[model samples]
Target: ANRLLKALFLVKYVDTFKATPRNLTVLVYDRFGLDLTGLGKQVQEALNLLEAQSYVQRNGNVYEYLTNEEQEIEKEIKAVDVDSAEVSSKLFRYLSSDILKTNKLKYAKNGQDFSFGYKLDDVPQGNQRELTIHFITPETSYSDSEIAAQSMGRDELRVFLGRDKRLLADLRLLLKTERYTKQRTNSGATPSMQAILQSKQVLNADREKELIERLRQAVGKAQLIINAAEIPSSSQDAVTRVSDGFQELVSRTHTNLGLLGGKVYPEQQVAGAVQSETGLFDAATLSALNSPGTEMESWIITQTGLGEKVTIKKIVDRFETKPYGWDLGSIEVVLGWLVGNGKVALSVDSNPVVRTEVTDLIRNTGKHPHVVVAPQKAYDHAKVAAFKKFCTDFFDEGAVPSDPTELARFGKDKLAARRDELNALVSSSRYPFVSQLAGVVALLDEVVGKQVDWYLTDFNKADELLEAKEDLIDPIKSFLNGQQAKIFDETQALLNTNAGNLGYLPTGSADTVKALLADANAFRGNKMNQLKTAADTLRGQIDDIVTDKRAEVTAAIDDRRAEILGSTYYANATPAAQESAIRRIDSILARLGGETQAALILQTGATFEQDDYPELLSRLVEAQQGGDDDAPPPKPMVSVKSISVPDASGVLESQADVDTYLAKYRAALVATLNDGKRITL
Candidate 1:
């Protein structure tokens, strides 16, 4: 529209694009060959009005056409905006990619060496070494000045996780399972697919979920190796151990995927490999792809919910004659069209069957237990909500067929079959309330599409006759239940009046009141509670069964739930997944109290299973020794992490903390090739 308008406006002067540059202004009268002199202020007034609208803007002596970005916001609000229901629904389906999550990494980033910050008693046995704790700091480049230990100048001013802590984490490691969700783009599937692929491209390989998961697993078993080292021979050794910790982690990670002959077989390759949460969460936050589930469901779930399996028919005949209400013919036509499109499926069975026969299913670890794919990340909250609303309101369920031949055929073929019974019911005083049902439908149409301008501007008899089938059916169900309740009450009253009905017992005895035949089977003393307890116990056994069977449960559980959990897949299962989760729990618990580790854990819940407890000694560590207690410790370690980018496909230590990573990455990428170094990019 903008392009067409611009082209039409340009044709007024009949000049070349080169002559009429974008910023140049042209008088409307000269281009259209219309005179403004006779019109006086009227012509100029209208042009000025157009200028205020921002479709065109005024320059020194001319009008400049505005780009789309420069256009003024639309002032006219439509009645039925539906506020993004269509887009939001899509986001919910693919929530994992769009959803954001944060996880804690263990241990604070302490540098290679530092002055002992506190008394000898302050050091915990966790990272052991008694300290003389003299601090030496670099006051200037090339000068390692021995100042008073714990000097408070330039070096001391820095604080690792202050308010300005870096949020630039490796996204792949940050959000696994979590996805950035956005509404489906209005442009259709091609662009959407392209965007998804682009997202995949942008994801850094090292930060993938599978890689991080492997590191987490390896770290779980490998950290115990560090426990074996009795002392740090040098400060650098401590740093080296932390760096090596990452590799030790990678080498040792155990996966739910089976290892054949102590190695992963090609067939055992899994899509379930643990990736880095650090990278993923950050990326998810930035991109707003967190709502993977919503995106998938808006388009896909409709097939299941509105398919041929669901059949709609009027229960009563009288309702058909009501103005604009659905008749038996209308229902048949809608159902037939739906079936033709494969939108509905007919099934005698209550549940649908799934087919899942395959090999090489994805499972680097067993089904990740913690999270679902995000529907939409919080980043695009407003947009996703708006799109979802649009889908619900604007999507036409295809146009209704109105040919005379088809209508007559539907009346004969479908309605005639049920005519006798429907007629009899209609004649009866208790004919079902279909008119009441139709009104509810109209209300819902307005509600779901309140923002849609068409709904507000128009009204029709068909709208009044539409029915919210689910809502109408609910009251019918409730009324039937009420009748059933009355039947029970009447039976009870009759039982209470007769002694012979009470098994020939004494009239006043409690036993006489307990009618064996009339009472509900569940009324036995304490049996309700006893049965509930049994049900709970059975449920627990099911959970336990899953835990126990995790070992041979090497196959990934990526299949739809209805397909798995059958007799076949669990033919010989073991506790492999449960054990893995338990091991992770233990590993996380072990790293408790380390500042950096705690920070990561607090955000992520627990990356690894931890098992340590706090002691009273922890209280003593923070105790002040003198007055004006702002005094600093003799020496303290500052946690550090590093990543060095080289010209070649360089290596990175996965375990390095932010500082070390920043230091190395900056040094490698700081200068340009023109400055004597090849650019890291």
Candidate 2:
């Protein structure tokens, strides 16, 4: 026990640290060169004695030397004969428990040998269990290189060589196993050890050059996988060697290995340097690992084929798992590319999403969005081209759009603008013929404005509808060109004719024009014919009015002439008197003929009145017959004294009585004047 304790303290002193259980065990074997056969019981006895005396404290499998009597212990260890067979066997047993406790291996003592196997629960199945046995012989050396080399030959070796060369070798073995497991799982066929090691030997690199060369080969393999998956060239840096001599492969490609999945593990530790397995770059395992964009497209197509209504959340969930494990940002970028290219259709709350809006929609979790394959019709090149041509021809300011989203924008922004323009044109006061279009304006509103508006939320449907409704352009053009233009010309012609003939249209004819302008259907279909007939009728009415006015004026002139010629005043007159009266009547008739139809009618009544032209003609005749042209006519005096007062106050009690009184007064005054007699009021 003193010898073993001195060895423990010596190891700590030599290594300048506390001795771990494995360290103590390794030191005993190196120093004494002991036969490790049948040593477990003797090693337990030494530990039990040292622990009872408090010379050492046991922490897990490590014996920590605790004695203050270091000098005495060292002196006793120096005096003892550690080379004796019995003492050697006891020294062997003294620290064998350390190695035994450090592992889950079951040991059995033979005559001159110890056999180690896995504990029952830890044992591999069938023949693998037989390969797990570790034999420590008299010639065995407990060194890292030896243990690492030994562990490589056994497939079922499960020992953990903690912080030792064997740990690195085991880690390499673990990487190999992971690669093999992934290959077997993917291809369902076991890869030979020779094949796995042919690229680079396993647990064989002892120098920096070999390790660096291995790292380069690993990177090359990872690049092949990345290339096969069609990952962007920028992602080639996913596996790269840093300045620190460690190769780190980023785990962007999520794949499952038995022990290395979704984690950063040290693949091999050499010369204080570590190689980390940050990703799975095995091509066979990553055979299903496609580029994010391509994988997402395939997923959507497959889901659609399965009759599944795939949501954005569902896609995020799918890609965020094994095999295609992608970050949310990566998923969004790929999804946007697919949608922008018209490969897939995206919608939020049943409203279609355009390419530019996909990123925001994906980021906003509150919006539940669905994805599916875009309809072929929405992107049909022939249909899209035809529709673009239609838009270019129909709209005055139209521009050809490239995709469904741009087309939707055109319909909303451009087509809507055009519709408003048409509406303004029809409703404008400058184009009074717009009233002749009947349902043309309404039709434009429906097709150009409201129909496009209805599909604004759905870019694909909007694109499809715009393509299918190209026929509406021609009819709208025809209405503006044929019916509206023709009616304007015809109506203006009629108004000009009326202005030339009668100076102004009559009140009834003006009202007819107003009604035609007011009725929206007045010039629609057969109504257009009716408008022409109404215009013709208006023209005819003006002509008739002019004719009747002229005839009336003619009659007035004839009657005045007859009055002067047939009267005794003109018959007994001199020829000069007759000529003078005839000249005066002809001058009045000529003045009436030059006036407008309305003015002529007004002047006809006045010109033929006895107090007007006829009175003037009579006076002219009298003057020509030797009568005084300026003689004052006899005046009859109106005297109130000669009239008797009718009780006007009594009769003027009401408005009717007052009116009757006024009528009598007027009659009496007129009668007095006619009789050439004096009358009293």
Please, what is the whole-model Cα lDDT of each candidate in the order they appear?
0.28, 0.46
Global Cα RMSD, each model: 54.6, 22.3
Please give the lDDT score at residue 598 for candidate 1. 20
Q: Judge candidate 2 at residue 608 and give its lDDT.
A: 58
Q: Note the residue pairs that clash in candidate 2.
A: 43-93, 43-94, 643-680
Residue 167 of model 1, lDDT score: 17
In candidate 2 the C-alpha lDDT for residue 65 amounts to: 66
Total clashing residue pairs per candidate? 158, 3
Task: Give the alpha carbon lDDT tens digit for every residue of 436-548 in model 1.
Answer: 43344334434332222222223232222223323443443343355533433443444444323223223443332233323333232443344444334433443343333
| lDDT (C-alpha) at residue 580 in model 2 | 70
C-alpha TM-scores of all predictions: 0.12, 0.35
Error of 2 at 573 (Å): 54
